[model samples]
Target: MGTITQFHLAFPVRDLDEARHFYGEVIGCPQGRSDTSYQDFDFFGHHLVAHISGEGRPLQSGRFDGEAVPIPHFGMNLDRASWEALATRLKAAMVAFHEEPHLRLKGKPGQHVTMFLFDPSGNALEFKSFDDPEQTFIP
Candidate 1:
């Protein structure tokens, strides 16, 4: 594998203060640059900008491995230890889970653990871990 590059994503949010609290305090992302219209966060080594739009759309669900998962979500693929730690932190923060953390595709290739949740702005996020990291991109 070659060098991995960081990703940048800009999404709309209703309030900047709420975004800061959720991403900074609850999710544990370090705050970066910011202004009246937007705020940046170090989201799991990726660039995440929350722009003030004062509105957000409802999330739709999609089928995945016999489970309903929130569509148009964004998240990181972590190791099992980190994934579990984050899950515990989120639970302690009282954040509701869109899909509880659980294993999927048992005894099969690409089997992994996954969980889903939403931000204060209603943007869905997923965090998962693969049994075999090498199988991440395997079909």
Candidate 2:
């Protein structure tokens, strides 16, 4: 197999401490170096940094596969079991889901499990997993 690369993402947050709780505790992201202004998180295998962008940010949505998806959302792909565990955690936390968890492309080439939710900062995130990992890139 070829080398896999991790990506870095920096997004807005209303409060640093709240961001810390959401990303660190809620989402299970391990906390990294942080200052008063920004903090980095281990987002599954990616680098995610949250910056204090103040309050009352607008949320946008788009349609995908007949479902309303959060515009400009970020997330990761996991195996089925990991995805379910995270889903349970999010539900136990009473995290408000923009779109409840469901299956998409059912009985098709790219069938998968997906769910969407937002952080306290209002940034959207979608976590999904495919029945067959190899179908991920299929058209």
The list of candidate 1 runs beyond 4 A from truth reads 1-59
lDDT of each structure?
0.72, 0.71
Estimate, for each residue in 61-129, the C-alpha lDDT of model 2 and write its tens digit.
434466655556777667787788889989999988887889997887768888988898987787877
lDDT of 1 by residue, 26-104 (tens): 9999886566666768777775667666456533543456665555567766777788888899999999998888999
Clashing pairs in 1: none
lDDT (Cα, 0-100) at 40 in candidate 2: 63
| Candidate 2 Cα outliers beyond 4 Å, as residue runs | 1-59
User: Candidate 2, after superposition: displacement of residue 13 in Å?
Assistant: 23
The candidate scoring highest on lDDT is 1
